[model samples]
Target chain A: EAGVAQSPRYKIIEKRQSVAFWCNPISGHATLYWYQQILGQGPKLLIQFQNNGVVDDSQLPKDRFSAERLKGVDSTLKIQPAKLEDSAVYLCASGAGAHQETQYFGPGTRLLVL
Target chain B: SQQGEEDPQALSIQEGENATMNCSYKTSINNLQWYRQNSGRGLVHLILIRSNEREKHSGRLRVTLDTSKKSSSLLITASRAADTASYFCATGARGAGNMLTFGGGTRLMVKP
Candidate 1:
């Protein structure tokens, strides 16, 4: 089986510019998540989706960040008017929606905002 | 806020030695998982230990969880240069939307 897949492994953008990242999760996985990992820090959950429905997005910056999992297979995360603080690795993961199931992660999209 | 915190932000050891990393959490959790990332790539799941379980072993990796103390330890036996990577501990709680809260990772460098 194929693992989760992401596009544009690395991205460089200027502050105030917009950027978007895409993620295609593993087949049959119902839970998809987006996380941000700043340098020297652990990944912080930005949003989570379960079969096209958002499970949680309390940490997402509503003013600047938004994500959607339309059709529930692939998802996209976008940041408009990006800021320097938004420079971080964006990771996407998927799981089987079980309490004990392990999540599979994709090669993250590293964004560098200047 | 991050739920878990790993100790010893960085560790360096020679090959063939055992490497131990510790993680402590603030709230109750259903399970704790350990992952390894190589050169900023995607993270690979190493091990997972449930709250009801005390210890688990997978090949050279051993994980011990102490719910009473809300701490966990990971031991890599006879470490190799290939084991050099950043290790992170993630906690899954019952009320935390089933999302894993990761701790700041510990960077381990195994010298040959």
Candidate 2:
């Protein structure tokens, strides 16, 4: 089976600018996740989707960050007025279920904000 | 708050030797998983050990889980130069709303 797919392997933008990252999860997977991995740190969950409905997004910066999963197949995460601290790898993962399932990850989108 | 924290932020070893990385976590977990990342790229799943299972093996990788201690360890036997990468342990906790919390990771360098 094909793994999760992401676009724009890398991107660079200036601070206060806007950028968007896209994710296409594995087929038949019911759970999708977006994680931010900062340098020297592990990935942190930004949002989670279960069939186009958000399950968790408590960590998301609602003021500037917004995410949506349309049709529960393709998802997009956007950050308005990006910050230097936002420079990190955005990882997309999919799993068969929210629990007791292994997750498959994509190559990720490496974003750098100057 | 990160639920998992790995010890020995980094490790350097020679090929053909065994490499061990430890992870400690707070609260109960349904399982623990090990993942490897190369060059800051996406992580690749290595192994998973359930709360009830004390140990699990996949190829040259072995994972041991001690629920009593709230800790786990990953052992890579006969490590290779290609094995040089960052290894992380994530805990799946139902208490944390069924999310997997990852550790800071252990950077391993294997010299051939």
In terms of DockQ, the best-performing candidate is: 1
Candidate 2 docking classification: medium
Output the worst ten-in-a-row residue range by lDDT, candidate 2 chain B. Answer: B92-101
List TM-score per model, in order. Answer: 0.97, 0.96
Model 1 per-residue lDDT tens digits across residues B1-112: 9989998899999999999999999999889999999987989999989899999999999999999999999999999999999999999866524789999989999999
Kindly provide the TM-score of model 2 when superposed on the true structure, using C-alpha atoms.
0.96
Show where candidate 2 strays beyond 4 Å: A97-100, B95-97
Clashes of 2: 0
Count of residue pairs whose backbone atoms collide, per candidate: 0, 0
Q: What lDDT would each prediction earn against the true structure?
A: 0.93, 0.89
Best by lDDT: 1
Listed in order, the DockQ scores are: 0.69, 0.57
Q: Which of the numbered candidates is closest to the native, going by highest TM-score?
A: 1
Name the weakest run of 10 consecutive residues (lDDT summed) in model 2 chain A.
Answer: A95-104
